[model samples]
Target: MTAVPTISSPAHLSSPDGKTAMTHTPLRIGLIGAGGISHSHLRHLLTLGADVYVYSEAGAAELVALYGGTVVDSLDELLAAVDFVDVATPTFTHHALVKRALEAGKHVISEKPLARTDAEVDELAGLADELGLMLFPAHVVRFFPEYVLLKEAVASGRLGDLAVLRFSRSGAFPTRTPWFADRALSGGIIMDQMIHDIDIARWVAGPVERVSAVSSHAGDATTPVEAAHVLLTHSSGAISHIAGIWGPSHLPFTTEYSVTGTEGSLAHSSVAERNYISHLASTDAPSGLLPEVDPAENPYFAELREFTDAFGGGAAPRVSAAEGAEAVRLANAALLSLETGQPVDIESPSAQATGK
Candidate 1:
């Protein structure tokens, strides 16, 4: 059991106009879910100029001890205490937790896919709109330099009208918790894993026009949801192929995204890797060198900062809740395709509500 730190106010700083200094009052934040990713969020929150609190079924003690923050025993207490809440729980439980926070009048940021189903996403979106509260999804990749670089590469015409994209992410089943094996809970590789690619494809390219998929199961898995390979076509005429597998591997839990165009191509082995490790290397000159300091940091921190800043007082979110819903809609389409063994058009009415 680590000791949670206490929140302290910062020294006042004056603006250009000599009015009374605005006290560095940290934005009070309540965190949900205490899993692998939650720790990352907890650690980074400590670095921010904000106050922090946490609520989780199991890891709250550990998190509080590590961050020197208070761990409330109930969601109600957590909600009342914070100006905003972040939900890092498993995919299945995201909706309920986020809904509660929103209903409490606290701003929210949830880990991607808004919910397990399109209807859930639609419901959340409507509720957030009605409440006029910020509902951001942690599509942290958008803040990655590699994604920024890749997106700019395509947008700059360095990669001519993108012709094709092939993305893959694979790893053994996560051992963090046993719930990962339950398809109803995990939403399979397509929902849980390939969605990053699905969102990336839609983001870097354009609207997904259609989706088709095939999957396989290991012995005794007893679930139709398992490893899968999917193909996607975009309205911009770009074709995307994705392969996602779950099993043991030496270099497992890797992500690979590559885009080919009339002019050129750039491939990133893994979005997470590229964000964390690739920045140290230089491609400007041959025999690229790594700096003493990585210079670049995890994009997740920046993503959360933006959400908080906006929730504190700013414009719209970078990864809006609607885009999160759109990504899940594509994942749902892939699931539909897997079941029917045929291609599903993204233009279908069910998918169209996502606003592309």
Candidate 2:
């Protein structure tokens, strides 16, 4: 969740007496990068009633026009004005922006892969700890209801001991900003896209022991590698496979999750233009659920609410900095495995060894 202030704006429609009747906490929010993902952040921030102060190289006017707020021209201005900051910039720049914001004594909600390297992640984690401030990584899938249900089901032994888990995610290429295709900026699709599933694999199955994978670039693009298939082995004796690609059409995006266990198997999918959750009690009978999807409401708000709650209560974030680091670790290992034709150890400290 973005830590933006609420703006109760009645200024344009106020009485001629120069008085406006509205109330707002006025969270000074400094948002970096106005990209596609940033729009979701902006919308959710507005919905959450935050004082939206946008910061982007361009598109400031458009954002302000739509969201009814001002856009600060300089990062310094943003730092001085905002209570907290949200970094939605290119992946390579996230660490520097977050580091600067935290150094300025402001709370931060960073977009992902806290840094390209574990060393950088460790540095940021240590700094946040020293400042006694909040630094939460954006792992929005954890907030999705389906994911929540799956986690609960697994934890409660409803699915028995896990035997296998498989995830399939694909979609058409996003009309993204140019930075997205640059491998240096985005770390390719493995980190940019499939990392979400990698995190999910660990979250539901337990710590991953090793990973093996294969990858390819987006056609002839020189930037971020675009597609991947990864295999994961968990410490709990669970074997999992994940596939991500960017060639689907006729559907905006699709995801399928299947977990097989000693007692039963549960499958959930956001394909066929429907989201379904089903369970096979035995080889013979099956039961399923279809939860209603409400328009204009989502788990992202809840994710933000949880972040603020943790900050206010002096508790750890639901998804800690360490977890984000580990996600990056897994991504790095998978890339290593893909390049070297071998299983990469998740706990390996040296990049050379992991990539071997």
Which digits, one per residue and each the tens of the lDDT, describe model 2 over residues 46-97?
A: 6656766888888877876776666898889989988788888778888889
Model 1: residues with Cα > 4 Å off, grouped in runs: 1-24, 219-226, 249-251, 270-295, 348-356
Alpha-carbon shift of residue 7 in model 1 (angstroms): 13
lDDT of 1 by residue, 157-246 (tens): 999999999987765555446677666787778887778778877878877778899888864443222478889888778899999876
Each model's lDDT comes to 0.75, 0.72
Q: Which residue pairs clash in candidate 1? A: 2-65, 3-65, 4-64, 4-65, 4-68, 4-69, 5-67, 5-68, 5-69
Model 2 lDDT vs. the true structure? 0.72
Write down the TM-score of every candidate.
0.82, 0.80
lDDT of 2 at 253: 55
